[model samples]
Target: MTQSTVPPLKVGLVGFGYASATFHAPLIAATPGLQLAAVSSSAPGRVHAAFPDAMLYATPEALYACDDIDLVVIATPNDTHFPLARAALEAGKHVVVDKPFVLDTSQARELIALADARSLRLSAFHNRRWDGDFMTLSQLLAEGTLGRIVHVESHFDRYRPQVQARWRESGAAGGGLWYDLGPHLVDQAVQLFGPPATIWLDMEQQRDGALTDDWFHAVLGYGTMRVVLHASALTAIPAPRFTVHGTQGSYVKHGLDMQETALRAGAALADGWSADTSDGVLALHTAQGVVEQAHATLPGAYTQYYAQMRDAILHGAPVPVTAESAHDVLALIEAGIASAREARVVQLRGQV
Candidate 1:
């Protein structure tokens, strides 16, 4: 098919909640060659208010059955991701599942095989890969400026001291900060250093009356390298978003990505939309003394994920976040959970 003849792929979002409203919907609308054709939401008024021209379905099943939808985006809760994605793929639609792809690796593998059999594009929205700070860090690593990374620390702390009445904080399957934020950190780690050989997890319910784990500290061991992932609900002052130390130097980033804040404030997509204001500190161990310098942050492009997905469907380009890569994340998550529950270090078995 010629580029000029290819129409915009009709997209159906399966949820209109925080992830849908804040991240997926805006990014989808911003990307070219992709159309937000419909959405599945309990509150049709909310969907209509945000996207008046798009059709609204009362259930995911209805949305999956829609012949107009060429792609289905599953932005619902963590628990619903697997079934919803399966249904969409079964309906002969390309699928995109939000982060923490699914509850387990088995589910991820199933979806991957199904999508492969159907010759459809399937991806997990590991959008943090597009964060300005992370992008900068990735560049630095690729350049080998940090030189033989020995220790890496990544954090996603928050001060949600009050236990909210939500499924995330509830004592349900796929509930807790571990499952919520673990995927981002783990995926980033795996992207940088491949899979860890061993995993050690320490998870707890720190907030008062919190039924699920509100805090977790996971240690991923990659030979001599150590990657620590941490998140907490009671943290008043959070730690650095990323800290990497190597044989040659160290890099420390202070703030989280600004895209979330921008989207929350309803900022329009513009030039330099994802540029970070704060600079990361890089300290190099010179022969004479340690030389410190400020590293310019890279511009993040979350819309690139959807754009690549559009290209993959229209032009046969590679999907940005493949189901195989996301399956590795789910494997790490499962290992972490087992390590925490069994009070022992778990060895990663398969190829990541």
Candidate 2:
């Protein structure tokens, strides 16, 4: 029998909040081999307004029951990730859960095992890996431009002094800045330097009337190397997005990826869409003195993630972010929380 070409993968997105509306849906629509077939959202009208042709389901259970959906993207609240992903996997659909894959490693491992048993692809949306500045830093590290890295600092600070009345700002499970932004920083650090030997964390509720923690500083110790990840809601003057120090030099980048701002502003994907205009400073020590030069930022490609996911489902390519890698990030998050609660450094036992 002659083999037939498989049609585009039909995707059902769970949730229509900032992550789904601003990132997942848009990228899925833009990718070549994926179709935004349906969505499960509380606000059906909003989903229709944004994606006029998409079929809307009132609940994820209904969307999961639909036979046409080949893939499921979970962009709901962090606490809802585990159950929804498990259900999607049980339905025999490939899955993509947004970062902080689940609340803990056990839940992640369960989903991983189920997906593997079903021979389905499972990925985490660690989109910041495609950030323009992070791409540049990856290149520098790979090329040995920074020599032996000794210390690295990453910040995801914002100036939201007023606390909003939302689940993220409430005392609910999987709420707070650590669960909100800590995954990005922790994932980036793990990508750069693998799992740390020890984890130390400090967290606080800095803003007035803040119910959950809005500030966090985590230190991932890799023997001689130290990776510092910090995020806060009350940072009026935010620090550099990334700072790296090595035996030979230092690199500091000052801006976040532009794609997010553009997406929030209802901008479409086009030429130069993810380009970062802000240049980073790279300082090298020379015989004469220190030489500082501005390094041009690389163009971010968040859409590449969805495209890769498509290929992984259609052509047996590797998923962009593996379930195991995401599990490692979750382990780090758990360790950080424990360290904060116990006021001691938590030791990691196994590989990421």
Candidate 3:
């Protein structure tokens, strides 16, 4: 039997919301080995306007069934992630699901099993791991400049006081700020320190008439080390993005990387686009004394995810954000939800 040559991966996108339009689509189109073949959106006209050369499908099924599309990137609502990803995998297409993975661990496991059975690449778009500030921190940690991490604090705060009427504000599966931002925080913790022995979460709805949790604080207990993950919709005065205390010194940083904002503002991916970012304020506590703040360079590369995904599909490279990592995130989310419901600490089992 003569082997067939596989052309470049044809990528299909679902949903044109903030994530797809700003993050996924632009990054996918910028990636070299992938092509924006089609998009499934109810607002077909808008999709056509954004991607004039790409085919527009009235339904996700239509997009998935197209013979030309080799990968499906799901950027839909939290509730639809499972169903669409499952359908894509069953249809023999490689799948990339946006964050929060799914509402529950069972669904995540099911999709994992399905992808494994089909020998397909199944991944979550946990792109924050590539944040420039985070990249700097990762380097410091690996170089032992921070020594043993004792306490880590991560925050994703915003001033969305007037809750927009969306499924995220509703009391639905994968709803609210926790679901929206928890994956990034939790994934960072897991990447740095692995799984926790126990998790304690406090969640509430501070917004008027809000149905889902708009505020959440979770503490991942890793023996002596602790990671605090917090998010709130009512933050008027946003706090530091990252604060870490270690035996050798402590690091405090404020503000988010500017790549995503730049990408949303129609910045092209070429040149120094993704590599540029506002220098994060860094205050390091040394034995001599607290060092004065300095501009810490951030080398953000959001395009790296798509590039790796393309290579994984084309050249059999390792998928940077693995399904196992996503499973750990979902499991932590489940534990956090459980803790909030029962008002107690939840012990995590499996996946150490």
lDDT of 2 at 298: 98
At residue 309, candidate 1 shows an lDDT of 95
Ranked by TM-score, the better of candidates 1 and 3 is 1
Per-residue CA lDDT of model 2 for 1-352, tens digit only, reads 2123557789999999989989999999988778999999999999999999999999999999999899999998889999999999999999999977999999999999999999999999999999999899999999999899999999998999999998889998899999989988898998888889999999999999999999999999999999999999988899999999999999999978888998888777988888999999999989988899999999999989999999899879999999999988988898899999999999895744
Q: What is the lDDT of candidate 2?
A: 0.92
Query: Pick by lDDT: which candidate is best?
Result: 2
Give lDDT: candidate 1, residue 18.
89
RMSD of each: 1.3, 1.8, 2.6
- Model 2 is weakest, by summed lDDT over 10 consecutive residues, at 1-10
What does the lDDT read for residue 143 in candidate 2? 95
Model 1 worst lDDT window (10 residues)? 1-10
lDDT of each: 0.92, 0.92, 0.87
- CA shift of 40, model 1, Å: 0.8
Clashes, model 2: 0
Clash statistics: count for each candidate: 0, 0, 0
Q: What does candidate 3's lDDT look like per residue over 112-164, in tens digits? A: 99999999999999999999888877877898776788998999888888978
